[model samples]
Target chain A: MAATYVSYFGFVIKSVRGMFTGGPRYYAWLSFLVLLMAAGAAAYYRQAVLGLGVTGMTDQVSWGLYIANFTFLVGVAAAAVMMVIPGYLYHDKAVKGGVLLGEMVAIGAILMCLLFVMADLGRPDRMWHMIPPFGKFNFPVSMLAWDVLVLNGYLLLNLHVPGYLLYKRYRGEEPAKWLYLPFVYISIVWAISIHTVTAFLYTGLAGRPFWNAAILAPRFIASAFCAGPAFIVLVLEIVRGWTRFPMGDRLITFLRQVVLIAGLINIFLLISEIFTEFYAASAHVASARYLFFGLHGHDALVPWIWTSISLNVLALLALVSRRFEQRGLVVRNLPLAMLIVAIWIEKGMGLVFPGFIPTPLGEIVEYLPSANEVVVSAGIWGLGLFVMTVLIKHAVDIETGAVAKNN
Target chain B: MSGGSRIRPGDVKRRGFLKLLTALTAGAVTAPADAEAFDLDAFLQKHFHQMSDDEKRRTLQRLEQDYNDKYERDDFTVVADGPTPGVKFAYALNLSKCIGCRRCVHACVQENNQHRGREERGDQVEYIRVLEMEKGSLDLEKAVHDYDHEVPAEDKYYMPVQCHHCNAAPCVKACPVEATWQEPDGIVVVDYNWCIGCRYCAAACPYWARKFNWIEPRLPADEINPDTHYLGNRPRYKGVMEKCTFCINRVRKGLNPACHDICPTGSRKFGNLLDKDSVIRRIIDHKRIYILKEEVGTDPSFYYFFD
Candidate 1:
């Protein structure tokens, strides 16, 4: 067992060196990526030094693109559970090694979600008030408190469950097979709960009529399943092209099916939302009107929402078509890329913009992303992606028994 | 004879005094073993059927006193036989006989102990949202109030909106926290401390009767209302919401809100909607009185009838 661990670790070290010197000039490319990250860091500093006033957010549109990204990323994190639970708990051999990557991605996405919330809060210093005893933490009553708890819990689960399995495997020690089954079941329920609660956080608000709907929780889940699987597929393609990652075709086929099912549900939910809004045409429907059809002088959100709907339909079609799903790498990437973007738009803008469309005065106002807002949002994305890249690299190494020999 | 002599009046009297002292001390320390006991769980468990006659009498007396303390006032007690089944309130608005001076706004700020803005910023904290509506557009929809422009721009009518003390308030129902509630005589009040700052009440209110303090409220000591109600304009804590309470302190004290007393245009009106002979009732019956967002079905006590 010790010899196996040592040999695996040695292989990882050689692989890292080979990529830089012996293999295709990947080291040079990595250096360029580092430079890009440095640029993102500079932008992040500007945000920290200046107050939230520097952001594109105004009193009229208190939350803007950053929150949209945060919302979208949360859905992505929830999507990882789709892979983890089915693969481990259900004993799916095709999805075994693949599930760890999803969990790693979740860890990255959750960290970004937390960071986005910190950036959103004007007084980030007072976040400690969320702690107990000294702080006034209202349990079960404040949804914000619940969000903090669940997001953190989900992230820890992703880290520990996968991390433990990978650790045991690297040691060439037989990991207890039944150990993860219970966790996998918990992850399945927890995964659905995370996204559902996030939806409830918004829809539960009786004040924001735009968000107050019974369909929202299910809509969020549908979006998560659609977007989450789509993202994983895209990442798999990228990994396959770049490195000698052992990704199975069976796993890809399985994910594509899940994406198609989720996509149909997402589209259905969108239609139902429109029906409820147009049919009722009540005072509560004003915000939805502003989002879809321009409210009194507030036509800004109409184009964005329409584009989102279009993208969603297009993505759904791509997934439903078996020809497109099982196409050549380049051809398949197109639909997968489109699906990811479509979900991002649907989750980010479609989810948040409608809530603010018709102002309390029944006036429609537009939210334009200021440069600062874009940069800050970009920085957060870069950070999450960067973290994801490192974590996935470590995971991939661990999985193929390459990182064992180095330690 | 010796035993009788030993049991003297002095010893007997001393024993009686000690007994009386012990009884008085116990009574003072524990209060009465009635409904007002420290053990609320025990008191709650004791069913009405189980309650002693003395307990029932004490409870009734306490309830009666609480009722008197909450509602009854010497100046404005409810008169069941009157035109309205409550105190008669009269509102006199003479828009034709006035100018758009914002003295009323200032009066409201000072009288209500509003948070003072920074000296450098010259901030305005007026709850009364004044709308300078254009003429010939009788519809409130075309009402364009350029707040950035000076007050009373040429050819504009000033309209102010506050908590309408609505008879059927939508805000009261929308409040998940039960922070804002309707008073017995039809006044809407917000308990600032009790509010969770979720802003649901603000969204539900047709008249926009609520305001959320996004940041901590800053007011000088002198600016604070010493006689502040927990529900009304007390110095609000951060993260809680607040709003106009119809000057609840003065309203309960048989006085009008400062804004009403200081309005130059007499455009602002107030009164008991129930009173038949009252000016508010007269305006509602005789003239076209409009409530903001009437489609929302929030029956506002604050009515606007063009002169």
Candidate 2:
């Protein structure tokens, strides 16, 4: 037993050391990420010292960019299930080869989600109060508490699955079914729960009519499947181009089909939400009005929502058109990139920002993230990308037998 | 003057540099000087309700010392008194008598030690927001809270909203750490030290009563209210949620709230809801009363009445 633990420890140390040794282009990319992360740390330090007042947030619109980004990234983290379902349930060999990479993306995305939540907090130092036993954990009651549990749970599942699989691969042994199979299945369900709980964070609030719709959870799931697979398809392409990871074109085609169907359903759910909000025209429609058009001539989000809608339509059309099948790599990937960006805006700025407009007291105060906020957000994204680059590179090296135990 | 020649590059650069310098200077001057040191006492302090009697006393002493040092007043004290038994506090406002003079708004700020800096400084927190509404319409969408006109416009009525201290308070339920809860007296209070400042409670409140300390609260030493309840007006830190405690300190001592006392028209009323002879009970029993956003089902202790 002790021998096994030592071997595992050795494997981790060697794999991590190997991650530091890469090509010139990889070094340049890492350096750039480091620069971004440094900028982010500096900005966050200033914010901590000066307070959230440095951001554009006010008592009128209490939440702003950080929460918006946190909400959107939760979907991205949940999207890893798209890879899990096909790879494990259907036994697709091409996808099974890349599931570990997909889980690595989940790890990176979840890290970003937690960081965004931390960035949004006013008393992050007092976060220990949420811990169980030692501090109060208002579980089953506060949706935020449920979110903390599910997010951390999802992160653990992803970490264990990928870690166990890679260690077995490094040792050139087949992983026992019981060791990882049950977790794979549980992770699929857990993935859905993470995003559903995140949606509940917004939907459970009776105060914000804009987010009170039953359709929100379904919309979150639909968008997650679409954006999640679309993102993986893009990452798989990069892995295929940059390294000898042996990714087949067939996996890309399969993920594209998933994205196409999920994207259609996402658009359908969005239409349902729009119809429900606009058709009835209740007093609750104030927020929706502010989002889709202008409310009392305070139309900060009108352009944003329209642009998101137009992009969603265009991306869905591109996915459906024969041109997607006939085109080369760049042409095919454009729609996927477009879909990712559209969902980011639709879920982040288009969803979270409008909920605060026409505040509960019927006040309309527009919120735009300050430059400091934008810098901080960028730094987090840079950190996530840096983490993913190192993780995926190490996993690819192990899988390709380039960093085997014998070496 | 030609558009191209309106400004020289040298002049523009110098102006920009001066502006940046002024902003930096202002930020430096306003930034809390004591913020650099790690506050071990605050870090290790237990939740208000969870602390033992001795711990509570020690915590209160530490807080009093901090406040005294910051405000330069040795008389400042932090009281952690429990709720008065058998007293369920409630409030009522006579809508017909309200003149919208905004005296209650300023009075609450003074009594509560709320942030009093300009908006640009990020410390302008006022618990009571007076909405100027069209008398004929019940629609809040048409209500204006930022009116600059004279008192009591011909067709307008003023509605001042604060923490309703709901029977089933959504903000209390929304707190992930149980940092805020309804006291025995039906007043909802937040442990400023325990809050993580996620602002979920702020979003959950239909009345928009809870406020976040976006910046460190800047209370001028002279304006600081020394008589403070621990859960009520004791100074709050940046990144925590605070709300109207229904004047927990004053009401428990048989004194009316600052807002109620300062109302010139006798429009605001406060008393024990559990007492049958209380003015709040009398108003609810006899007057045409309305609960704001009753559809939300918060069951607020506060009511609006037509006298």
Candidate 3:
């Protein structure tokens, strides 16, 4: 089945590459690159000239889309570690083919994380202060400093481990089998740590009662696994469509099982959050009320949250159903798309906005990212995809040994 | 405008040089002797003792040079010198008489060097919130101060809340940067330069006394007060946090708070807690007074006394 899958995909790729011959696809890729660079230049110019005010953020909502995207991307990045560790360290042959692809996802996700952090900083120039002594970042005390250290460490790990393996393979030297094993274990634990720490950034705030739950970090991990695996599944389908890679339906079924478990955990964690908030009858319950219904007179966030909840339920049902998971194309694709959108809305506005409602001053200030913010975000995403495209192209070339065959 | 040798000492005529020197000599010789003999160190020492004699002299010289270059007046400096030995500062408010006239608010802005911004768009000057209250209810739960309607409304009594200068301030405790600290006199002061703008202190303050400058504060140069304290408002940079210092710069200098002094009804009272005869003490003894969020055990130095 695997050999047949590879040969059939190879035939399609050869035909397409022969017809294109570095023409239309190349131009299309170039156009995307131009669009990305233009958007980045515009955003950079605006930020340099007008300061953070160009981002549509105010004192009331000091954070905007930058932070929400940061949170979401960190979760996605952490999920890559799970795939790498299980496949390589534990010798899970079923998942081994995904190990390289998982690292590639981390490379793109971490870049997004860094960009988001840069966008949110009031003095992006002062980011160098995170370096050491002169800047006095106040380690251990500030969760931000910890996030900076861990994220960079993870990026370094991904870069060196994968680059070394690829280099050895290119030289026709057999790579050390055990070289990636230890890193894989570390990566697994590190993956869970990244999302936990990201969640810690919000939950550690004692003042923001909405985020002060002990279950918050666990919930973050569960949701990250659910959305991250689902995204990987979608990427697998795209890879299958575009290239000669032999991805098996059985592997897709396994990924669905992972998603189903993650979804169940995510739903359970959210239920626990609701239970605690409603049961406690504390002032903190005010935040929950604002999120689910409305507080005082504000209702902007209610509809978006309900939609996330419904989509999550629907995705969970589809993913757990064996027939639905195995179904070709449409049925399998719908659940993955639904999970991604559900987590996006949930982690983006649903998670952040409620944490600020009934604000410290008892004001309900609604937040909406401006047009510039949205455009800049889109540009960042395009840049990530551009990087991903180059990476996948390189990986496929190495794996196939014939650039033309892969193309 | 030249390639090196165009302008030289020979470019100026000898006659012009001599005339210029003569004018300088005349100006120097005939200048006010008192101005030349100014003993600012001696005078300033009499007022501000915090500085050592050498420090005083250097400060005096720096001040003269600064003034000579640009004597842009309206350089208001609120004094922040420590009080006379046995004095312990305290404040009390007569909530019953506060008419919500905002006279105290205006006075605070001026005295504390708060930059004025647009009424609708800019940040508030001081850290005081004048919450309107109900006649029969002291219960904050029943308080109708958070009305969506515009303010200066009829049938409401105002209760102004500043940094209670809490004895157990959450803001002081939560400052990871140590930018904010409680002074011996029970006032919480922020080192504006040291603050990282993390907003942790702002979040911890239950009274919401702190305000973050999300944008650089813009004050027209003419309006910039020349007299500045480094820790108080000289001119804060963008992103740092600031709050009311209870007119620390003034009250520590043995002057009443600008807000108390300017109150039309004398609703705000400030005095030394150690002095039994202080008017603030008399108000505390004679009237019904309350500190906000008292149940939280912050032990605030500020109080609201019923007239």
Candidate 4:
């Protein structure tokens, strides 16, 4: 038992050492991420010193860019389940080889989600008050509490599965099924829960009519499946190009089918939501009005929502056409990139911002991300990418046998 | 392994990277001196309801001292008095009598030590919002809170809204840390120190009564209300949520809320709702009363009445 523990520690050390040994291009990419992260840290310092007031948030529109990014990234994290189910349940050999990379994306995305939540907090230092036993965890009651549990649990599950598998691979030994398979199955279900709970965080609010729809959870899951796999498709392509990981084109093709179906379902859910809000046009539709069009000349989000809608339609058409398959790699990947941005806008600012417009008192307060907020958000994204880049690099090296236990 | 060959520029680069990392971390850790200092006791302070009597007393004293130090005033006092026995507080406003002078808004600020800075600075926090609506319509969608005209336009009626202190307050249920809850006296109070500032409660409130301190609240020393309740109008920090506690400190001591006291037309009324003959109870029983957003089912203790 002690020998096993020591071996695991040695594996971690060697893997970390491998991450720092890449070429000049790798170093340049890492340096660029570091620069963005440093800028973000500086901007966040100003926000922390002054307050959230440094952002464009007001008492009327309390939440802004931080929460918007957090909401969108929760879906991104949950999308890892698309890979897990196919690799573990269906035993797809192509996907099975790349499951660790998918889980790495989950790790990176979850880390970003957590950072966004912290940035949104007014008393982040007092976060310990939410911990069980020490702080009053309003579990089973507050959806936010449920969100914390699910997000953290999902993070741990993603970490353990990949970590265990990578360690076993390093030893050139077969992984014991009992140690990691159960967690894989749990994660498949756990992935769905994180997004559902995040949806509940918004849906449970009775006062925000814009988010009170029963369709929210379904919409959240559908969008996660759509955007999650699309993002992984892009990452897998990068891995194939940058490393000798031998990822098959068949896996990318299979994921494109998943993205297509999930994207269709997402579009359907959105249409259903739009119809429900606009057909009858109740007073509760003020937020929807503010989002899709302008509310009393406050049209800040109108252009954004329309742009998102147009992109979704364009991407859906591109996915359906299959003409891109004959074209170059960039053209084939264009629809997926378009879908990602569309969903980002739809779920991020498109969903969170409008909920606060036409404040509960029937006042309209428009919110825009200040320069500081944008920098902080970009910094977090840079950090997530940096983490994922290192993690994937290490995992790929292990798979390629560049670093071995015997050596 | 040719260690000597590899150690030259690589070591220098690694050292440079480490130095950069260390500088970034140090920059992140070192907050401005005037920003809220890291207080160990304050950081580790227990939840307001969970603290024992002695703990509560110490916490209150610490808060008072912190406030005094921040404002450079020695007279700041914080009280942790609990709910008075057998008293269920409620409020009523005579809608017909209200003239929308906005005196209650300013008075609440003075009495509560609300931020008095410009709105652009995000420190301008006000508890009461007076809405001017068309006389014949109750549709809140058209109600204007920023009407700049003179008192009570002929075609408009005024409705002033603040924290309703609901019997089934959604904000309390929405609080992830249980930072806000309904007290024994039926007042929904927030433990400002315990709040995580996620603003979920503010979103859950249909009345839009809850407010967030986006920036460090700025109250001039001369304008600071020295007497404060721990769960009430104790000066708040930047990034916490606070709202009208129906003036928890004043009401528990048998004084009316500043909003109720400053109403120029005697439009606001407050009393112990548990009492059979209190003015609030009489108004609820005898007058035509309305609860804002009744469909939301908050079951507010606050009511609007017409004589």
Model 2 is docked with a DockQ of 0.43
**Predicted candidate 3 versus true structure: per-residue lDDT over B275-300, tens digit per residue:** 89998788878888887767666788
TM-score of each: 0.67, 0.95, 0.76, 0.94
Model 2 segments more than 4 A misplaced? B1-31, B34-36, B119-123
Q: Rank the candidates by lDDT, best first.
A: 4, 2, 3, 1
Q: Stretches of candidate 4 above 4 Å error?
A: B1-34, B119-123
Give a tens-digit lDDT track for model 2, residues B193-250: 8999899999999999998877777778898889999999998887889999988888
Give candidate 3 regions above 4 Å deviation: A1-30, A177-180, A279-281, A328-331, A402-407, B1-99, B112-115, B120-126, B134-157, B162-205, B251-307
DockQ of each: 0.03, 0.43, 0.07, 0.33
The top-ranked prediction according to TM-score is: 2
Interface RMSD of 1: 27.5
Ranking by DockQ: 2, 4, 3, 1
- Chain A TM-scores, per candidate, are 0.90, 0.98, 0.90, 0.98
Q: Name the lDDT value of residue A405 in candidate 1.
A: 38
Model 4 C-alpha RMSD vs. true structure (Å) is: 8.3
Return the TM-score for candidate 1, rounded to 2 decimals. 0.67
Worst 10 residues of 4 chain B by lDDT: B3-12
Clashes per candidate (backbone, < 3 Å): 10, 0, 3, 0
DockQ computed for model 4 against the true two-chain complex using alpha carbons: 0.33
The model with the greater lDDT, 3 or 4, is 4
What's the C-alpha lDDT at position A217 in model 2?
95
In terms of DockQ, which candidate is stronger, 1 or 2?
Answer: 2
**What are the chain B TM-scores of all models?**
0.64, 0.89, 0.71, 0.88
Which candidate's lDDT is highest? 4
